[model samples]
Target: MLFAGIKTDIAVDMEPQLIPLIDSLPSTVPFVGPEALERKRNRAFKARLGANESGFGPAPSVIAAIQSHAGEAWKYADPENFDLKHALAAHLGVAPTNIVVGEGVDTLLGLAVRQYVRESTPVVTSLGAYPTFNFHVAGFGGRLVTVPYGDDREDLEALLAAVKREQAPLVYLSNPDNPMGTWWAAAEIERFIDVLPKDTMLILDEAYGETAPADALPRIDVSRPNVLRMRTFSKAYGLAGMRCGYAVGAEKQILAFDKIRNHFGMNKLTQIAALAALKDQDYLKAVIARIIAGRERMVQIAAKNDLAAIPSATNFVTIDCGRDGSYALAVLNALIDRDVFVRKPMAPGLDRCIRVSVGLDEELDYFEQQLPQALAAVK
Candidate 1:
């Protein structure tokens, strides 16, 4: 319309420019949320047992901190993230310079990809690991070489072989991995590190670290230039909505985040929530115990159905439905239809299982009652 007078014989086009990488990208999310499904079903989920979010809730101290500081939302958060960095550093026995706080691990992952992934830059990861990380790589025009899981766990040896074979500049590993909910011991992780090529950067995602055994987490080592460890306030702290996470590595590697990170992207209240959550160690331990109990209950529910719940170091469990991907998917749809929100891994070998997040007692009860019904209906 603006060009009505100037266009004469030619038709007006209002197309905006987009980068080729983005232009070629598909508009897809890693996981469709329960809310979206609810919209389609026209009903609410009775059992919210997906997303691996803590149903135990954040520490009371964190809630209080958020309430006390809620009025200060007008101001921008400290771009340096000074208080949080210092708190995390002191807790982890590292220098503040070794920590880089971001909106969440997902954001930090994107930043990491931005720093390293150029067109066709080879990045290695388990085929069905964190899809968001893969999405970031794709967004940045990186070439992904995926290794399949071994025995329901990420094949660390295969990952190393691929990295060495391709001379990949970057690789991703999720300890206490998402979707699968399996983990490697710290000693095993150390051995994996030993074999890595010196120049390859490893993105070690430890989002479920709090729920994992202490022996599963290697001690904080900011000395490693080739590895960045990602942690979050989302899982045990029940602050996923707060969007706060941090990455730790050598000072230089941490500093690299500064070059491309959105300095003022952090919200003021999230800082308060995370700091308060960190201060309450007892609450975190209690939540961990609750998560363990919840995991047991879920396992019991699966067993009653003659299914096997995979041993999990993370907050959730992957239940083997004793069938192929199609059957597992049918069970998942059945659960969804029954107002029990759950998720499943869709990769070739991993698709025979359904993932269930730890939830409250009532929610678990709903799941318990509906799972058998779902199984029968699926059959």
Candidate 2:
């Protein structure tokens, strides 16, 4: 080694080479959790109505199920998720093989992106659709082609057109959407599916299906390889903390999830909780009714302040502030300052509205009391 006693000119840089893709990517987090907001404000919100979580809480049976399964925490969840899949299939009138249960609809979205998208692979969605899905597409190096919402609902025709023009491998549509809470009838969605490019795989995220009208959800048809229907226990089921959800699609398409999914990601207790929740249909029905009642109350609150609350089919309502994003942001901040938690859309066209989730009467009353002041402060 001493024989190579080199000159200074022979010395070379020792830094590791960074991936070019890493340099091209933007540093961003998709959605900021409420806990982060609490940390920033250094105060607890008197009313939590932002995340669209079911404040009504999970079913008593589900809670009991979780408690009973507490002792099973030491064991890993079943990799196959066989029992849950079977239960879901029986409930949805589909075969067990056509179902794939995951940690939540969010995780399933990532799995779907992994299965179909690659560098520069085209993916289609609405401009302000679920940000988590968009985040997954970006993480996998996919090219996103977004269509603007038409009449406050996802533009089905425009989405299809983008998918066709881009020859996109995947497309995402959230029925009874987040932020907006707008929905199309079952027939309309069916029509949209029919017109979709045969080769393009559609992800129909129905996270709020239980809250929607009976005819809002199309019949379960796992026969089509191009369509995957995603549902979650987080919304109407009130098991947001449990993190349980599933996808129903053609048997072949469902099996692809097995190639990449984190097999033991589902907590054993979550499975028990979801199963019990499913079994208690009466409780689910009651919660849905209460959510509807809450939505009506929210609408009344908005009307009292001379604001227009958009009609909703989900657990949340979007109130139009009759102004720009800045004003809406101001109103949101004012509400936050008043110890009321809420959120708003940030995309250009949709940003004029503040989205509020269904909460208890006291929470809604607090919101009602603070809303006028929030509006005046913003003004």
Candidate 3:
């Protein structure tokens, strides 16, 4: 009614059409971040514990390195990621040829999916394991075959069986899994790998590997062509703001990534930060100690509230709410309303739990103070 001779139609849609695979996909994010929740409630959270981020912060040396490289931001990062790879190779006891650096674990995961997943290709993973992997698979038009978590752990045998049954090329396993914080011993993982078909690929998402016990990670061997181990600086290194991660695999498999990878995805500053972080193993050990202490505190808080805190090998703890999904969700909502941010599992078997990331002592104190009231409100 307001339009005059000028005439205004705001919506304009004419471009080369989106590919059918991409157009058919649902508009969804892998995770609705804490920032989004803060916006929705129109108030900042007292404790940011929803996302599994390391609040301990990066080492001072890492920060200094980033600062040193700040002026060099105009220069595109080395497309080869040469220096970082060499450093990682020396640190990991592997050759530089085995490494493929990318923006983050998320981007590397997408590249892996692209390499192995195609329209109608079957991919296997635990039912509620990392959602980002599944998001990538769906975007690539792959059929997801998820096995149920058995005893709060990714059922490795079940996953292997499903992979065999479906003849899937790609399978994902998150050691010290998200949402549950459960893990499998490295020996068990090695056995599973030994049995997997040679042609099949395993995408091992080891984003939490830095916080896990040493034995929890299998030895790095670039001889295995079918396995890709992905790790990131975002977790224990506390460089979530810097987009950097790398994968270790056989040389041939690693070289294949060069085909489709974003050549300049690595930020110059991020490379410097990651290099500094790798050199500062002492700082990493201190952070891990603090994370373990914080986890113990979280467990104590949960127990005080009469909830069962699951044993965690990661930087986060999943507290069992001793009820159904609805009740757990109610508790989650109550926490949100009380200015505490936390998340819960939505998969069938894992739904009776809420996940909380390790944060600073004062931040966790806010949670400790608010949790009882939230539980009572839910009750």
Candidate 4:
């Protein structure tokens, strides 16, 4: 007992202060992966459609390449990433100097933001587009100016308007966008690019390019110093686990990546696997055809429940649940509870839809069997 205001002293331990910059940042997890879901549910998902990954898997040649290169894992990957870049350039009909390969589109995005954005630098993207880009912007203390989707598609006109008005140094657009597999034809994207401010750098993500129609992708224009076209082995190449992707741009723009990117981030096996995958065009075409059929099957499944599936140019189809975000969330949770993994959009107006990736026939059958029960549970 103390007579004064202060009590008797004991041992005191002071906690260490975190970096002010880190303290200022909010705690967040950008994406909840399938592995995390499996851990949380304490069971493996019967049908994995939540992540928009290609279920058809990588080409046999690619797998063989990986197997062959498995012994090379002891050595670090080439810092210059020369062979991969050269192969990608040749594949894309560009000079080797015009390409930069990174861990994945996500990592490349972080590098792009780091190279351009500083504290308070303006960046523009759709309100409901890829969240990873927004996450990178926040990480770099960039000001994010978002425009909403128009009829489930990123409004190219509105995005350009925002970039101009804000004089934003960076802008992000995902063709055949995630959470809503909508896309614009190449002509529209080219027009959008033509109107963008010269100083503004555009990160055009074509992660699902392999699944999209040829006309849906704009012709490669490496002369445009302001535009960077990103492609991923994660989607159609079925190499998401390998984390391989590349960005094509003008020589100078591509070189800028070297300034801030992790030089040895690319794995040796991944390089070999992607190169093999690139050479197997027949496998890719077959996978795309299968994806188209799977999308049609998903549409029929939605129609069976009186829901309308949005037209998609990507591997996944966004089905309008004919309700609000809460209803969609309920439906998503119901499906998850049934061991059929799926995902839904969290942004308003677009949140009435649940995005499901193309899985195997058996997986889709599981989804079809569980859909009515999941809907009933939600209702």
TM-scores, each model vs. reference = 0.97, 0.95, 0.95, 0.95
lDDT of 3 by residue, 1-379 (tens): 5655775665577567899999999899988888898899999999988888888899999989888779999999999999999999999999999999999999999999999999999999999988989999999999999999999999999999999999999999999798799888899889989999989999988899988888999998789999999999999999998989999999999999999999988899999999999999999999999999999999999999999999999999999999999999999999999998889889998999999999999989999999999998888
Candidate of highest TM-score: 1
RMSD of 1: 2.2
Against the true structure, what is every candidate's RMSD? Answer: 2.2, 3.1, 4.4, 5.2
Q: Please give the lDDT score at residue 185 for candidate 3.
A: 85
| Candidate 1 accuracy as TM-score | 0.97
Estimate, for each residue in 31-111, the C-alpha lDDT of model 4 and write its tens digit. Answer: 788899999989999999999888899999999988888999999999888888888888889999999999999999999
Clashing pairs in 4: none
| Full-model lDDT for every candidate | 0.94, 0.92, 0.93, 0.91
Which structure among the candidates has the greatest lDDT? 1
Score residue 112 of candidate 4 by CA lDDT: 95
lDDT tens digits, residue span 1-379, model 1:
5766674555467567798989999999988988999999999999888798888889999999999899999999999999999999999999999999999999999999999999999999998899999999999999999999999999999999999999999999999998899999999998888889989999999999989999999887777899999999999889999999999999999999999999999999999999999999999999899899999998999999999999998889899999999999999999999999999999999999999998899999999999999999999
Worst 10 residues of 1 by lDDT: 5-14
Task: Give lDDT tens digits, candidate 2, residues 266-342.
Answer: 99999889899999999999999999999999999999999999999999999999899998999999999998889
Local error of candidate 3 at 92, Å? 0.2
What's model 2's TM-score? 0.95
Count: clashes, candidate 4 = 0
